[model samples]
Target: MTHGFRVASLCLSLGLLVSVVACHDNKPAAETRPAANVDVINVALRDVPVVFEYVGQTESSQQVEIRARVNGFLEKRVYTEGSLVHAGDVMFVMDRKPFEAALDAAQAELAQQKARLVTAQANLDRVRPLAAKNALSQKDLDDSVGQEQAAAAAVEGARANVIGATLNLGYTTIVAPVTGLSSFAKKQDGSYIDATNSLLTYVAKLDPMWINFSLSENEMLDLRTQTQNGTLKLPPIGKLEAVIVLADGSIYPERGYIAFTDASLSSETGTYLIRAAMPNPTGSLRPGQFVRIKLLGALRTSAVAVPQSAVQQGPRGAYVWTVDKDGKAQQRAVETGEWNGNDWVIKSGLHPGDHVVIDNTLRLMPGVPVKANLVATPPAAVNIGGPDGGATGGQQAGAAGASGPAAANANAGANAGTTAAQPTAASGASGALGEHTALYFASGSSSLDAQSADALAAVARRLVAEPGMRVAISGYTDSSGSQAANQRLAAARAATVRAALVVAGVKIERIEMRKPAQIVANDPPDKSRRVDVMFSPAAGG
Candidate 1:
């Protein structure tokens, strides 16, 4: 080891031994250790989706209640219960003795009247000749003509009565109005049932069952916005597919389609009713059976996400650990949305390529050395970011344009060695009330420099000057060692900064500490370990 800021020696990991030749003119230069970490990006953006889900029950397209049409004794049912029957199929037969007798009597009267009409027609035929010859008195002939007309009218009335009686007898037999499944008849043999009695049964058509559901106004609005922004995707037209789930949790294989939608919203529920038609050939589905409808909407636009472990709460707000060039740890603030379990959906403040910690959260830091398991990331994680095949992003553009974690690691290694220009950074400060915070690391660790205390002290001074101002610091480590070690180191770095602030007159109550980011790398994860501080109320003024 060389003393006084200029010492250089290297240790090799595997079993490689090599020595460098001594230089004759030694004007010493600072030596740098290799960084084993990678760089990564995290960003925040809204990912909208077009969702279709609602609960509904199966219903028959047509149903009819069977009732009696005439008063009579209960008769035999022509069809079995729950059996399909065609239109005009007889359902019940009633006693028709009284109607049959009335028909017979009317027919007999019509016969007697028809005989009179025949006699009158014969007389009129003879009288026409006599009137021309003047062989009979004109008054006598006219009288015969009047008698014939009366008999003809009586015969017509008798025929009409006969037809009415016949129809009355037919009404004793009940028929089905439509083709459908007939429920059990309520009227039994020997029971008196008629048009005025209780319902006999019901018939329902079951070939194409209807599924009804509702959609709220808010849901409709969301769908419209997604379509406009081109974020959420759209499926086929009336061909929108849906899954039916019964109460048992098993998936229904049969597919259903959108049959119709209500024209207006319902005032009671503030929703519009939608109906889907499903084929039920075997009649496996019953009318009014409750079921859940699962519909898959269009795809979503591209989005980047990182593990919750990678994000830290700093004075400025929320940020993540990013490995920069030279394998150094850097704090990057991030905006995020929903929690995707092991990962966080970054809404803003992240980019395509970014190395993020996924496992061993306790060992992550800005500049601490970390070793990524090297296991390829998975692609299909139920809307997860990427796949081991290197395919990621929900949106096509995101998948095509986004960089993988490997690229981020490479970038971090390149950035770790150089520090940002201090003068330029300081000059960017807006005002006296504004405070700036920078991460520090352990000696030779880059994870969090032992000098973090000095940086935090400066933050403390700024906070006191601006009483209402708030500050946040995020810590990170380089990927130079084990991920576990890096996380601890990263956490310690943040604690040190907070301690420094406390000693510098900043209140302990005002400080907050957070979990470390898992940066993967065996060498420069140390550089990735760091704490980023932020001020509230827009800082300065």
Candidate 2:
């Protein structure tokens, strides 16, 4: 009787579990899952700016080698090594004794030749009258005339020698051929500078720096193909702007233009070499620095683009979620090109009027119903690697309001729901003086560029306006070259800043030169090579 009761209880429990399962399965799909809320943007075709990036190297437009014009002992180095030197600045002084002696000898020889010419003329004067009267033979007069002419010739040659000697003497004092940054002296003091070892130093002209970059064959071909098919439009070569990004991601303030392009590709690198001329009036940029070059002013006409966040990577390839006409989420694969600011350039797989889901994409799946809200599309501007939508290394191009009827229409459509705000300056004079300002230097150099000098001038003006204001300067250097050299360079950089401030009317006593903080070994060269100037109101601080 107990076993039969237990079996009846088990059957009743199974029936209740089955009934619960059937009720759950019978529920509507709406109760189980609802549509995902997503923010979508209507895709549009418009002209988009493209920036072609390449690794470039800085070079001096004029790199003059300072070599000895005459062989002599290097008496002394007049200019400091690795310093800014003006044109005609004395760089080296060779031993003047030897050249002086040679000049003296030449002058003495010239005087002797003049004396001989005088004597010869006197003899001819006497013989010419006697020969006309037949008092002396014609041979004597002829001989006298020949002697005078020969002596005159000797005098002319001697004068030429004297002039040459004077030039040689002047060569003993080596002056800079051009205004530029000088290099280390190759021949030290007291070293014999001969023809084989005449290289004394070199001076690299800093203003109007040259930047060299290259393009591969494939890249050129692709660009040509696009241009032929009316897909890419390039501005005039001269109008195409070039901007450089330093190693630490800082944009060079100056912009350059394309200067030259090689007709034939380089056989060695198998690439077409191109060069840009940057006006570096401040001498901030040095030769041989590898920087990123961005060439702007190219446009991709009728190109489709989407926000970077909208693009997703899957096992197959890059894809984006789009809302279809049925209000269902559909996965569309996309071929993406380079990044245009915060947006990704969609090469293919998208069309105009397509509602691409920019937000709430992660929760989406194919065939899932989505509640889509239209959002304004981002402006097509090149603002890569910048915080404030400004181009970090290049000028902002292809803005929504850029010239063209198509671009204007696209701009209007994209900004229909939003109002753009203008950006204001971040800091003013009072605010700038309260914080530290960094002055960056070129590698292994202590000379202040135009920008640095301007910064110091501002600080000087502030200090003059406020009597209680004081400044402390600290210098730093990268781990390149030698430790001793780096230390010296750092100290020199600090001293340069301090000196500039004093020259700008800031009291020397109010300025303090602080030791640089310890730098990491892996720090970037651009970040390491800088002088920090901190302002204070306290005298001791």
Candidate 3:
């Protein structure tokens, strides 16, 4: 074949053709190559949430430092270290002999003072009567009265000493001030501790934990702008909800509301500090654990969104390659908004139901013929916090990509649901449709690598074998670049999978591209960037 191509090239160069028709026979093989297959998604008008994600930390709701209330020698720890304890639970047992002895001495002193008071009172009574009868001087009665008063005063002072000694004795047994989880003891047994300066340990209330996060000045300003322009509507400050994503990619099951927000921004960081309270009755969430706080409430209406990869940057701002009616790639400049998961919110330069190319832009150019394949964006997994304050990870179904009539219909459904707050454990979304398997994509491109291709191939084979089955595809991208670009990338990934399935002999008529209810926002970009492929038995099969 190489020799034939070379001979043809030489013949054309020598101009040894009998006619124009004969010269056409020597056309180069490269010129006759087929158009590149480009993955595409249909853009649609849907309500994109105005979401803000921030790094946050989990802290104890109430942290109490344990200390010695009275100076004494530490005898023994009553409760186990790092154990849960209730209010009034004994934490430590100090040496009580000294306090006990002091209390006994005070009691004896009080008894002695009471005896003296009795004698003085008797003397006063006797002197008063005698003095009244003129058998005793008035001075004697007055002196007796004074002696009785002094004895009573001494008795009162001794009683006060007894109460003090009793209180000191009771303080020897240290107890928990609140119900919480305890830390290890800092002072060991037999250690001498001062009442005012000793720090024994700490007890932290963990039932309702605090999630601390900050919103930067730029984010705050952007939100205000969007709100003022009517692009976004925020919930009442008190009604705002907070969702926490733990370090292990699981969400904290219980929903937390904003407990407090700083009135002013911090001068050091130029950010407003915020705190949310999440119930951690099981003590699964610990203090100092890093987490991601998802503040839900702001809603964006009539927002156009696409995969981030579909958007490309250039000297003329950001643009995406779209397939025209003639199956040719065309460049469309676009304006973008904040990222909602892996997709970008397109503010302008695109309309609903516009086809946007999502993948294989490395070799694509404007006006070039493209084998545009319409595909649906993959369903993104929505891991909501479970009822038990743990993560229940599941995939959401019916995410259509940015392509074909299916996308338009899916967008309509999505728009209908946008008016309500995002669904969660507390929002009655337990019975919504969910996906079982997820399709993932590669970095920076929509073209499938070997692993993803193999996974898609299996689905194609299943579709070919089951003629009555229909599949739904949804695309997604990671938050790495401009929102427009990521949206485009997600769309392209969905289209590429559809093209592959078509090449494997599956009928295009059975495939439906879908817009996911939510976007998958995972790490490694490759994991978050994906196309979901779900199969269902055809109607009346």
Candidate 4:
């Protein structure tokens, strides 16, 4: 191949050509060169926080099954369907004929017993004096006393029977125990029913409905520990505010509180139950209703985050592509943490000033040219303490580059914020660099000799003194090796220069690295293993 030039005669010509092209054309011409299809993003800083969301159901605070206290037929149902009814409100009535007749019989028995008692008492009074005077046998007085005792016992038995009968008669009328909306009676009116009334109706309390949800055992422990340590604060009982999201996509106006939390962990399901109370005075939030439960308070301050679109998947791991001074794409390996709603929390491999690709990268790859657009105003207001708590980790974590439709649209602007490699051409010697100040290299190597490293170091030192100056380190490799291996070689060379700058005490934010760079190949040794470092004005300068 005509790549990896091993000589010095052509490097000067190549550098001169690149400079002329940069000055002559405002756009990249070779960027359209076709290769493997891919997308890219520029690494940048953002605000990210931790959040969580869950699905739950609405339950009545109090629910009871109304049953019959006595055996009888249901006479009437006093409450209307789906209407509020109070405790002691009549719910049903049974036939009263049997109980009423029983009461009357007991009354008659008690009256007869009373009359007999009066007669016996009179006989006892008359016989007592005779026994004392010896006018009659002592046995006769004893018999009178026994008769009076028997009559008194009979009266007491009759009174007990009357009380039992009256209680049974009262059972003929049934009523509600607590106030709530009444459901359809289980058994029809005028139907014979016994102690088992068969769930006549359900009365659900709505003023303060309970929302039941569960959290994993691990999560429970984490929460407990965090609260105790003051890292995570628990919402106050009956004080923490919450909102209800209905199925129709409308938000409930009233707020609620954290009512109760289960003390014991459930054995069947390794989780703890939580009951949050919500206001439903208008009766709009009905029982048996399903809803999305969300916690409304608490927030983290000035967190670091990035749009999901800025991250991508690579053969080695997740990555983000950034731009160099000349607009060439450079890939960097990154460690991604959990996603916070529409963004991701970057654990490593990025900084506050480094630009991350945020646009569609269907045609982008290592060494490809690009243009990035900076986003001044975000599309949506900060969703602070809002319902979209956080992203639930899933299979998508492995596929880093694929973004949902919403994420793609939200990050379109950053598509214009990338680094596109410009054609190199010799420029007028009137600026920061001398006319001969251009990149040179040894053949087919990523190792920068002491001379090259020192040259780049001097440039970095000068740029450090001049804030807002930029020097893009573009690495290249000969086509003698596989594309993947060559890409690594190019990247290693760029990384080498970056390390030197950092060692020289260059501001970390001012240095950018371009990898698997735009190739300038031939038989020459000086240009093959070189990193083409270009000096230019800082972005938006």
- The candidate 3 region of ten consecutive residues with least summed lDDT is 392-401
Candidate 4: regions farther than 4 A off: 1-52, 114-157, 195-198, 225-230, 236-240, 297-541
**Tens digits of lDDT, candidate 4, 1-541:** 3555644548878899999988889765666554433333334343333443334456788887777767777777877877888888887777888889988998899899999999999999999999999998989999999999998999899889888888888877777878777776778877877655545767877778887655545455544554575544444656555665555445678877778878897654344577788887877876645455555453322334567777788789888777666667788788775565567766677766666666665556777876566554232122223223334221111111113432232122111111111124423222233121234444444444434432443344344434666666665566666888777777766765665444333456776664444444444554456665555665211
Order by TM-score, highest first: 2, 3, 4, 1
Candidate 3 lDDT over 1-541, as tens digits, reads 9999999999886675466657687786566556999889877766665444444566789999988888889999999998999999999988999999999999999999999999999999889989999999989888999999999999999999999999999999999999998998989999998966589999999989997765445445655766798777788876777887665456678888889989997653344777898888788987755465666766676678787788889998989888899999899999765444556777689987788989999878888898989999633222233211211011011111122233233233333322111222211112223332355555665545434433443355345434677776666545556877777777766776666555344567887776432344543444556666654564111
TM-score of 2: 0.62
lDDT of 1 by residue, 1-541 (tens): 3553342233342213322323423548778554443334333343433224344566788888887766777667778887888899998777878779989999999999999999998998899789879998898689889989999999999999999988888877878887777887777877887556847888887777887655445445555665687755666647676556654445566877887878997653345677888877777776655555545444446757565556677788887766544455556787654343344556677776555544444445666654443333333122212111111211111111112342233223212211221211322122232334556454534233323332333344355444565655555555565777767767766765665454333566676564554445453543374456655554322
- Which residues of candidate 2, in runs, are more than 4 Å off? 1-39, 119-145, 326-328, 362-376, 384-541
> Residue 500 error for model 2, in Å?
33
The per-residue C-alpha lDDT of model 1 at residue 37 equals: 38
Taking the tens digit of each residue's C-alpha lDDT, what string does model 2 give over 1-541?
9999999999999999999999999987675587899999999998888776554667899999999989879999999999999999999999999889999999999999999999999999999999999999999999999999999999999999999999999999999999899989888899998899999889999989998765545456656767899988999899989887775567889999999999997553345667899999999998756555678898888889888899999999999999999999999999776566767788789999999999888899899999999989988887534222332111112111122333233223212211111112212222333456667777657755534433444454355445677877777756656878788889988877775555333567899887665467676557677777776785343
- Ten-residue region with minimum lDDT total, candidate 4: 413-422
Off by over 4 Å in 3: 1-47, 119-153, 195-197, 306-331, 341-343, 351-541
| lDDT (Cα atoms) of all candidates against the true structure | 0.57, 0.74, 0.67, 0.59
Better of 1 and 4 by TM-score: 4
Root-mean-square deviation per candidate? 26.2, 16.9, 22.0, 28.9
Query: lDDT of candidate 4 vs native?
Result: 0.59
RMSD value for candidate 1:
26.2
The model with the greater lDDT, 1 or 2, is 2
By summed lDDT, the worst window of 10 consecutive residues in model 2 runs over: 417-426
TM-score of each: 0.48, 0.62, 0.55, 0.48
